[model samples]
Target: MTATTADSVLTARAVLLDMDGTLVNSDAVVERCWRRWADRHGLDFDEVIKVVHGRQGYASMAVLLPERPMAENYAENREMLAAETADMEGVVPIPGAPAFMAALAGLRLPHALVTSADVPLSTGRMAAAGLGLPDVRVTAESVGASKPDPEGFLKGAAELGFDPADCLVFEDSEAGILAGRAAGMRVVGVGARAAALGPTVHVDDLTGVRIADAGGGEFRLTFG
Candidate 1:
């Protein structure tokens, strides 16, 4: 579903951002890798990618190849994905990423990156995108559970020295969004089209989104 547009700026104590689709444009690389993996396994590309977004690579592999040993599959996919050059075509900064990150830097609010991407993949993607990652980073290994479990985002909040209730979560996938909301933070859905679960606000991209850290209770946000 198309997300609801907001003109109101949200207030929060910290900001937590998703990496792949939210801050970095890994869509093409993700699409390419997932497609190759699916084709190798004779699985449907669309279906695999549908479940791939916002999930640890191994998590998606387990769901896709239920009969296979998940650990082995994860290893294989990790190896395959790594063999790919770090810099790939279509790898770039997501819309509004530069502005959003700069704004976060300027605001001086507690901010972090929470991603379903495993540490290696997340780091590679970030390097390819050339995005300045937040100091607080929560990767797949950060928690036993993945998105939709509230672990990743919550862990990120902790790293940022803020309570979940005081953080603002930015996500593009359903699992990520669910985790954010369940963690008790105001959710901001970022994507061209977000499947309608729900969130405090939704924007097509980070373009025009502004943030201000209000010292104590919350940080204020302005969106257009």
Candidate 2:
């Protein structure tokens, strides 16, 4: 549901953020990469794009090519990662992402990045977006399963020394929202598509989101 003024003050001990569509604006690169992959594999680009967001490359590949061996999926994922890192053509920070991160730092609140991208790809995209890396990051290699499984978000909360219930997750895709919910955290959808996923709170973007000192290791999220 969309955030109302009455629901703006959300209290949490930590924040969990998704990297791609949530923070880094890599839509162009992501679509380009996936489209090329789909074309080469004889899959419908439109259909492939639908399930690729908020999922690990390997996981998405497995869905697209269910009959492929695990080893082949891994190999293809590595190649995709390399391609993504090498091409930073349209990467940039999403609106309000910089300010939201700044608020997190300013409040001295704990936060972790939970992403489906592996280390190299995540780092490259973040760098291209001009976003600083968080203290704790949960990438594809860090968890046994990707989003829609809750493993990554659970891992992120654990690494941040916070209970899942005490963390607020910010996500931009349906899979991520489901994962956050499964992790027992309140989720704030960060985009229109995410909003459609029925997160606890939804915002068009991070533009007016701010952190307020709530004292005693807790902070209030002021959603604009």
Candidate 3:
């Protein structure tokens, strides 16, 4: 879907961002890795993709292969992580993501990156996308549970020193949006796919988002 502006304005003391689809355009690499893994497991690639986005590798594997032993899932996840981290081809910033990140830094806003990717995978992808790591990064290694569990988002809010209710989350997947909501934070869906998931506000991309200091350590997010 083409990009567009959001109708509602959102305000928050801090922001929590999802990495993969929301900021970094890593769909090519992600799909490639999952497709290879699916082939190895004799599973349908399309079905694997459907359940993989916005989730930890092990979690996705669990959902896709519920009958498999946890040890097997863990071993496969490690292999997938190694393959993904080694393949940075096609990784880039989502439209307007660079500018949006700059705006956050310019406004001196408190923000955290909550991702299902492990440290190596997340760092490699972010570097490939030309984005530096955020001050607060909640990766798979940092959380016991992943997206759709709320643990990551809640941890991000706490790390940023904001109440869950005072944080705004930007996510581009159903699992991530649900996680944000479960954390009691208002969420701004970052793309058409995410918007369809029913976040509090929907934006085509970060291009139309503007943040300004709102005195008293608050920030006003103006959505187009």
Scored by lDDT, the top model is 3
Per-residue lDDT for 1-224 in model 3, tens only? 01123546777889999998899989999999999889988999988998999998898999999999989988888898999999999999989999999999988899999999999999998889998789999999999887899999999999888889889999999999999989988889987778679888888988998988988888888887
What is candidate 2's TM-score against the reference?
Answer: 0.95
Query: Residue by residue across 1-224, what tens digits does model 2's lDDT show?
Result: 12344757688898999998899889899899989999999989999999999988888988889999989988988898888888899998989998888888877899999999888888998888888899899998898887899999999988988888999999999889999999999998898778778877788888978778878888888877
Predicted candidate 1 versus true structure: per-residue lDDT over 1-224, tens digit per residue: 12234556677778889887788877887788778888998999989888987777777787888898877976976675575445467878878888888888877877898987766777777777787877888876688977788988878888888888778888888878888888878788888645375767877788878776666746678777
Q: Which ten residues in a row have the lowest lDDT in candidate 1?
A: 1-10
TM-score per prediction, in order, is: 0.89, 0.95, 0.95
Query: Where does model 2 exceed 4 Å of error?
Result: 1-5
lDDT of each: 0.78, 0.88, 0.89
lDDT for predicted candidate 1 compared with the true structure: 0.78
